[model samples]
Target: MKKFICIISAAVACIACESRTYEEISDNTPIAQVVTYNKDVKAIIDANCVSCHSPGPQALTNYSQVKGNINSIIDRISRANGDPQKMPQGGSLSPAQINIITKWKTDGLPEN
Candidate 1:
Protein backbone atom coordinates (compact mmCIF):
# COMPACT_ATOMS: atom_id res chain seq x y z
CA MET A 1 0.00 0.00 0.00
CA LYS A 2 2.82 2.42 0.88
CA LYS A 3 4.66 1.61 -2.42
CA PHE A 4 1.48 2.22 -4.35
CA ILE A 5 1.01 5.56 -2.62
CA CYS A 6 4.59 6.56 -3.35
CA ILE A 7 4.25 5.67 -7.04
CA ILE A 8 0.98 7.56 -7.32
CA SER A 9 2.48 10.60 -5.63
CA ALA A 10 5.46 10.48 -7.97
CA ALA A 11 3.21 10.18 -10.99
CA VAL A 12 1.11 13.12 -9.83
CA ALA A 13 4.21 15.21 -9.25
CA CYS A 14 5.51 14.42 -12.72
CA ILE A 15 2.21 15.24 -14.28
CA ALA A 16 2.09 18.56 -12.40
CA CYS A 17 5.57 19.45 -13.68
CA GLU A 18 4.63 18.89 -17.29
CA SER A 19 4.23 22.04 -19.31
CA ARG A 20 0.74 23.35 -19.89
CA THR A 21 -0.35 24.56 -23.30
CA TYR A 22 -1.91 27.70 -21.76
CA GLU A 23 1.41 28.69 -20.19
CA GLU A 24 3.08 31.30 -22.29
CA ILE A 25 6.65 30.65 -23.37
CA SER A 26 8.50 33.94 -23.01
CA ASP A 27 9.97 35.07 -26.30
CA ASN A 28 13.17 36.59 -24.99
CA THR A 29 14.56 36.10 -28.50
CA PRO A 30 16.02 39.36 -29.74
CA ILE A 31 14.20 40.83 -32.68
CA ALA A 32 16.26 40.54 -35.87
CA GLN A 33 17.12 43.76 -37.73
CA VAL A 34 14.73 44.51 -40.55
CA VAL A 35 16.01 43.85 -44.13
CA THR A 36 16.39 46.83 -46.41
CA TYR A 37 16.34 47.03 -50.20
CA ASN A 38 19.83 48.42 -50.82
CA LYS A 39 21.50 45.97 -48.44
CA ASP A 40 19.54 42.77 -48.01
CA VAL A 41 16.73 42.70 -50.52
CA LYS A 42 18.91 42.85 -53.62
CA ALA A 43 20.99 39.90 -52.56
CA ILE A 44 18.00 37.67 -51.99
CA ILE A 45 16.46 38.74 -55.28
CA ASP A 46 19.68 38.25 -57.20
CA ALA A 47 20.29 34.82 -55.73
CA ASN A 48 16.82 33.33 -55.82
CA CYS A 49 14.40 35.32 -57.94
CA VAL A 50 16.38 37.24 -60.55
CA SER A 51 17.20 34.26 -62.73
CA CYS A 52 13.69 34.06 -64.08
CA HIS A 53 12.38 37.41 -62.93
CA SER A 54 14.96 39.81 -64.34
CA PRO A 55 14.62 41.91 -67.51
CA GLY A 56 12.05 39.45 -68.75
CA PRO A 57 8.54 38.47 -67.81
CA GLN A 58 9.24 38.92 -64.09
CA ALA A 59 12.17 41.38 -63.92
CA LEU A 60 12.99 41.90 -60.23
CA THR A 61 16.63 42.89 -60.52
CA ASN A 62 16.57 46.62 -59.76
CA TYR A 63 14.70 48.96 -57.46
CA SER A 64 12.59 50.35 -60.29
CA GLN A 65 11.40 46.94 -61.33
CA VAL A 66 10.72 45.80 -57.77
CA LYS A 67 9.09 49.06 -56.74
CA GLY A 68 6.88 49.14 -59.79
CA ASN A 69 5.68 45.64 -59.02
CA ILE A 70 5.66 45.81 -55.26
CA ASN A 71 2.30 44.13 -54.96
CA SER A 72 3.38 41.23 -57.14
CA ILE A 73 6.58 40.96 -55.19
CA ILE A 74 4.71 40.77 -51.93
CA ASP A 75 2.33 38.20 -53.31
CA ARG A 76 5.16 36.04 -54.59
CA ILE A 77 7.03 36.33 -51.32
CA SER A 78 4.01 35.38 -49.30
CA ARG A 79 3.26 32.46 -51.53
CA ALA A 80 6.82 31.22 -51.77
CA ASN A 81 7.60 31.64 -48.10
CA GLY A 82 4.27 30.84 -46.52
CA ASP A 83 2.32 28.72 -48.92
CA PRO A 84 3.10 25.91 -51.39
CA GLN A 85 4.19 27.82 -54.52
CA LYS A 86 7.74 28.71 -53.44
CA MET A 87 10.17 30.32 -55.95
CA PRO A 88 13.81 29.56 -56.69
CA GLN A 89 12.60 26.51 -58.69
CA GLY A 90 13.76 23.78 -56.28
CA GLY A 91 14.28 24.86 -52.63
CA SER A 92 12.98 27.48 -50.22
CA LEU A 93 14.85 30.54 -49.02
CA SER A 94 15.82 30.91 -45.38
CA PRO A 95 13.67 32.89 -42.96
CA ALA A 96 16.30 35.61 -42.82
CA GLN A 97 16.27 35.95 -46.61
CA ILE A 98 12.50 36.00 -46.70
CA ASN A 99 12.41 38.64 -43.95
CA ILE A 100 14.75 40.88 -45.93
CA ILE A 101 12.50 40.85 -48.97
CA THR A 102 9.41 41.33 -46.87
CA LYS A 103 10.94 44.27 -45.00
CA TRP A 104 12.06 45.89 -48.23
CA LYS A 105 8.60 45.76 -49.71
CA THR A 106 7.07 47.04 -46.50
CA ASP A 107 9.61 49.88 -46.30
CA GLY A 108 8.42 51.40 -49.61
CA LEU A 109 10.99 49.55 -51.77
CA PRO A 110 13.65 52.21 -51.29
CA GLU A 111 16.01 52.96 -54.19
CA ASN A 112 19.13 52.97 -52.12
Candidate 2:
Protein backbone atom coordinates (compact mmCIF):
# COMPACT_ATOMS: atom_id res chain seq x y z
CA MET A 1 0.00 0.00 0.00
CA LYS A 2 2.84 2.40 0.83
CA LYS A 3 4.58 1.63 -2.46
CA PHE A 4 1.39 2.24 -4.37
CA ILE A 5 0.89 5.53 -2.55
CA CYS A 6 4.43 6.64 -3.46
CA ILE A 7 3.96 5.74 -7.12
CA ILE A 8 0.66 7.62 -7.29
CA SER A 9 2.17 10.65 -5.64
CA ALA A 10 5.05 10.64 -8.13
CA ALA A 11 2.67 10.39 -11.05
CA VAL A 12 0.61 13.30 -9.78
CA ALA A 13 3.73 15.40 -9.29
CA CYS A 14 4.90 14.66 -12.81
CA ILE A 15 1.54 15.63 -14.25
CA ALA A 16 1.58 18.87 -12.30
CA CYS A 17 5.02 19.66 -13.60
CA GLU A 18 3.93 19.10 -17.19
CA SER A 19 0.57 20.83 -17.05
CA ARG A 20 1.59 24.42 -17.52
CA THR A 21 -1.06 26.91 -18.57
CA TYR A 22 -0.50 29.03 -21.65
CA GLU A 23 -0.09 32.13 -19.49
CA GLU A 24 2.59 30.41 -17.49
CA ILE A 25 4.40 29.32 -20.64
CA SER A 26 4.21 32.77 -22.20
CA ASP A 27 5.40 34.41 -19.02
CA ASN A 28 8.51 32.26 -19.16
CA THR A 29 9.26 33.12 -22.79
CA PRO A 30 12.71 34.63 -23.34
CA ILE A 31 12.68 38.38 -23.83
CA ALA A 32 14.64 39.85 -26.73
CA GLN A 33 16.19 43.29 -27.06
CA VAL A 34 14.67 45.99 -29.28
CA VAL A 35 13.40 43.65 -31.96
CA THR A 36 13.10 45.32 -35.36
CA TYR A 37 12.27 44.08 -38.84
CA ASN A 38 15.58 44.79 -40.53
CA LYS A 39 17.75 43.86 -37.58
CA ASP A 40 15.86 40.83 -36.34
CA VAL A 41 12.32 39.87 -37.22
CA LYS A 42 12.89 39.69 -40.95
CA ALA A 43 15.60 37.09 -40.59
CA ILE A 44 13.48 34.87 -38.36
CA ILE A 45 10.60 35.04 -40.82
CA ASP A 46 12.79 34.56 -43.85
CA ALA A 47 14.40 31.49 -42.37
CA ASN A 48 11.24 29.92 -41.01
CA CYS A 49 8.21 31.18 -42.86
CA VAL A 50 8.94 32.92 -46.16
CA SER A 51 10.08 29.76 -47.88
CA CYS A 52 6.46 28.74 -48.35
CA HIS A 53 4.76 32.05 -47.66
CA SER A 54 6.83 34.40 -49.73
CA PRO A 55 6.65 35.77 -53.28
CA GLY A 56 3.65 33.47 -53.52
CA PRO A 57 -0.08 33.81 -53.03
CA GLN A 58 0.17 34.21 -49.23
CA ALA A 59 3.32 36.28 -49.43
CA LEU A 60 5.29 37.64 -46.48
CA THR A 61 8.16 38.83 -48.61
CA ASN A 62 8.18 42.41 -47.33
CA TYR A 63 7.55 44.60 -44.34
CA SER A 64 4.14 45.78 -45.44
CA GLN A 65 2.76 42.27 -45.82
CA VAL A 66 4.08 41.14 -42.46
CA LYS A 67 2.95 44.23 -40.62
CA GLY A 68 -0.46 44.02 -42.21
CA ASN A 69 -0.92 40.45 -41.08
CA ILE A 70 0.66 40.80 -37.69
CA ASN A 71 -2.23 39.17 -35.86
CA SER A 72 -2.15 36.03 -37.96
CA ILE A 73 1.60 35.97 -37.81
CA ILE A 74 1.54 36.05 -34.04
CA ASP A 75 -1.11 33.39 -33.81
CA ARG A 76 0.63 31.06 -36.22
CA ILE A 77 4.04 31.43 -34.66
CA SER A 78 2.78 31.21 -31.10
CA ARG A 79 1.16 27.85 -31.79
CA ALA A 80 3.76 26.55 -34.19
CA ASN A 81 5.60 24.46 -31.67
CA GLY A 82 2.86 21.82 -31.70
CA ASP A 83 -0.12 22.81 -33.78
CA PRO A 84 -1.19 20.70 -36.74
CA GLN A 85 -1.30 23.76 -39.01
CA LYS A 86 1.75 25.33 -37.43
CA MET A 87 3.82 27.70 -39.48
CA PRO A 88 7.24 26.63 -40.76
CA GLN A 89 5.54 23.27 -41.34
CA GLY A 90 8.57 21.04 -40.91
CA GLY A 91 10.19 22.39 -37.76
CA SER A 92 9.82 24.82 -34.86
CA LEU A 93 11.53 28.12 -34.17
CA SER A 94 13.43 28.60 -30.95
CA PRO A 95 11.87 30.55 -28.13
CA ALA A 96 14.27 33.44 -28.77
CA GLN A 97 13.32 33.63 -32.44
CA ILE A 98 9.63 33.60 -31.58
CA ASN A 99 10.22 36.20 -28.89
CA ILE A 100 11.90 38.56 -31.33
CA ILE A 101 8.91 38.51 -33.66
CA THR A 102 6.47 38.82 -30.79
CA LYS A 103 8.44 41.77 -29.46
CA TRP A 104 8.51 43.41 -32.87
CA LYS A 105 4.75 43.27 -33.15
CA THR A 106 4.34 44.47 -29.58
CA ASP A 107 6.78 47.32 -30.30
CA GLY A 108 4.81 48.48 -33.34
CA LEU A 109 7.19 47.02 -35.94
CA PRO A 110 9.58 49.86 -36.65
CA GLU A 111 11.21 50.16 -40.07
CA ASN A 112 14.66 50.40 -38.60
Candidate 3:
Protein backbone atom coordinates (compact mmCIF):
# COMPACT_ATOMS: atom_id res chain seq x y z
CA MET A 1 0.00 0.00 0.00
CA LYS A 2 2.79 2.36 0.89
CA LYS A 3 4.62 1.59 -2.34
CA PHE A 4 1.48 2.34 -4.31
CA ILE A 5 1.03 5.57 -2.41
CA CYS A 6 4.63 6.55 -3.14
CA ILE A 7 4.14 5.84 -6.85
CA ILE A 8 0.97 7.88 -6.91
CA SER A 9 2.73 10.74 -5.12
CA ALA A 10 5.58 10.60 -7.65
CA ALA A 11 3.13 10.63 -10.55
CA VAL A 12 1.35 13.60 -9.08
CA ALA A 13 4.65 15.37 -8.60
CA CYS A 14 5.66 14.75 -12.19
CA ILE A 15 2.36 16.02 -13.49
CA ALA A 16 2.59 19.09 -11.34
CA CYS A 17 6.08 19.82 -12.63
CA GLU A 18 5.01 19.69 -16.24
CA SER A 19 4.59 23.00 -18.05
CA ARG A 20 2.40 24.05 -20.96
CA THR A 21 4.36 24.87 -24.12
CA TYR A 22 1.55 26.06 -26.41
CA GLU A 23 2.07 29.69 -27.30
CA GLU A 24 -0.88 31.73 -28.47
CA ILE A 25 -0.30 34.19 -31.27
CA SER A 26 -2.34 37.29 -31.86
CA ASP A 27 -4.00 37.95 -35.23
CA ASN A 28 -1.70 40.92 -35.79
CA THR A 29 1.53 38.86 -35.60
CA PRO A 30 3.45 39.26 -38.84
CA ILE A 31 4.49 36.13 -40.70
CA ALA A 32 8.03 35.56 -41.94
CA GLN A 33 9.23 35.60 -45.54
CA VAL A 34 7.84 33.06 -47.98
CA VAL A 35 8.86 29.47 -47.29
CA THR A 36 9.53 27.01 -50.07
CA TYR A 37 9.83 23.23 -50.29
CA ASN A 38 13.58 23.11 -50.90
CA LYS A 39 14.48 25.83 -48.46
CA ASP A 40 12.40 25.42 -45.33
CA VAL A 41 9.35 23.21 -45.72
CA LYS A 42 11.18 19.98 -46.43
CA ALA A 43 13.54 20.37 -43.53
CA ILE A 44 10.74 21.07 -41.12
CA ILE A 45 8.76 18.05 -42.29
CA ASP A 46 11.83 15.82 -42.35
CA ALA A 47 12.87 16.85 -38.88
CA ASN A 48 9.45 16.47 -37.37
CA CYS A 49 7.13 14.32 -39.47
CA VAL A 50 8.71 11.97 -41.98
CA SER A 51 9.80 9.54 -39.30
CA CYS A 52 6.30 8.17 -38.97
CA HIS A 53 4.84 8.88 -42.41
CA SER A 54 7.88 7.95 -44.47
CA PRO A 55 9.71 4.72 -45.53
CA GLY A 56 6.15 3.61 -46.35
CA PRO A 57 3.83 3.37 -49.31
CA GLN A 58 2.67 6.98 -48.93
CA ALA A 59 5.82 8.66 -47.78
CA LEU A 60 5.86 12.39 -47.11
CA THR A 61 9.57 12.54 -47.80
CA ASN A 62 9.25 13.80 -51.34
CA TYR A 63 7.91 16.86 -53.08
CA SER A 64 5.22 15.15 -55.08
CA GLN A 65 3.72 13.38 -52.09
CA VAL A 66 3.87 16.53 -50.02
CA LYS A 67 2.35 18.68 -52.71
CA GLY A 68 -0.51 16.25 -53.02
CA ASN A 69 -1.18 16.53 -49.31
CA ILE A 70 -0.57 20.19 -48.64
CA ASN A 71 -3.86 20.90 -46.97
CA SER A 72 -3.66 17.90 -44.69
CA ILE A 73 -0.07 18.76 -43.87
CA ILE A 74 -0.92 22.28 -42.80
CA ASP A 75 -3.93 21.08 -40.86
CA ARG A 76 -1.89 18.55 -38.93
CA ILE A 77 1.06 20.82 -38.19
CA SER A 78 -1.20 23.59 -37.00
CA ARG A 79 -2.65 21.04 -34.58
CA ALA A 80 -6.12 21.49 -35.91
CA ASN A 81 -8.84 19.80 -33.88
CA GLY A 82 -10.23 18.20 -37.04
CA ASP A 83 -7.38 15.75 -37.34
CA PRO A 84 -7.68 12.36 -35.67
CA GLN A 85 -4.12 12.93 -34.48
CA LYS A 86 -1.76 15.84 -33.87
CA MET A 87 1.54 15.39 -35.67
CA PRO A 88 5.05 15.28 -34.23
CA GLN A 89 2.81 13.47 -31.78
CA GLY A 90 4.82 13.62 -28.59
CA GLY A 91 6.15 17.12 -29.22
CA SER A 92 5.24 20.24 -31.21
CA LEU A 93 6.61 22.68 -33.72
CA SER A 94 7.56 26.18 -32.66
CA PRO A 95 5.27 29.00 -33.72
CA ALA A 96 7.98 30.12 -36.14
CA GLN A 97 8.12 26.72 -37.79
CA ILE A 98 4.35 26.63 -38.07
CA ASN A 99 4.44 30.15 -39.50
CA ILE A 100 6.97 29.08 -42.09
CA ILE A 101 4.77 26.21 -43.16
CA THR A 102 1.60 28.27 -43.21
CA LYS A 103 3.35 30.85 -45.33
CA TRP A 104 4.74 28.17 -47.59
CA LYS A 105 1.24 26.92 -48.33
CA THR A 106 -0.07 30.42 -48.82
CA ASP A 107 2.84 30.99 -51.20
CA GLY A 108 1.64 27.97 -53.22
CA LEU A 109 3.99 25.29 -51.89
CA PRO A 110 6.76 26.39 -54.22
CA GLU A 111 9.57 24.07 -55.22
CA ASN A 112 12.16 26.77 -54.70
Q: lDDT tens string, model 3, 16-109?
A: 9977545654243556576789998889889988988878775898998888988877777777544557777877777778888788888888
Q: State the RMSD for candidate 1.
A: 6.2
- Estimate the TM-score for candidate 2: 0.67
lDDT of 1 by residue, 62-107 (tens): 8778778777666665564446665666666665555566667666
For model 3, the run of ten residues with the poorest summed lDDT: 20-29
Better of 1 and 3 by lDDT: 3
What are the RMSD figures for all models against the true structure?
Answer: 6.2, 5.1, 8.5
TM-score of each: 0.58, 0.67, 0.67
- Clashing residue pairs, candidate 3? none
lDDT of each: 0.68, 0.79, 0.80
Clashes of each: 1, 0, 0
1-112 per-residue lDDT for model 2 (tens digits): 9999999999999988877655455644556567789988888878888888868668999998988888888887778466887777867766667778888888889969
* Model 2: residues with Cα > 4 Å off, grouped in runs: 1-32
Q: Residue 31: error of model 1 in Å?
A: 5.9
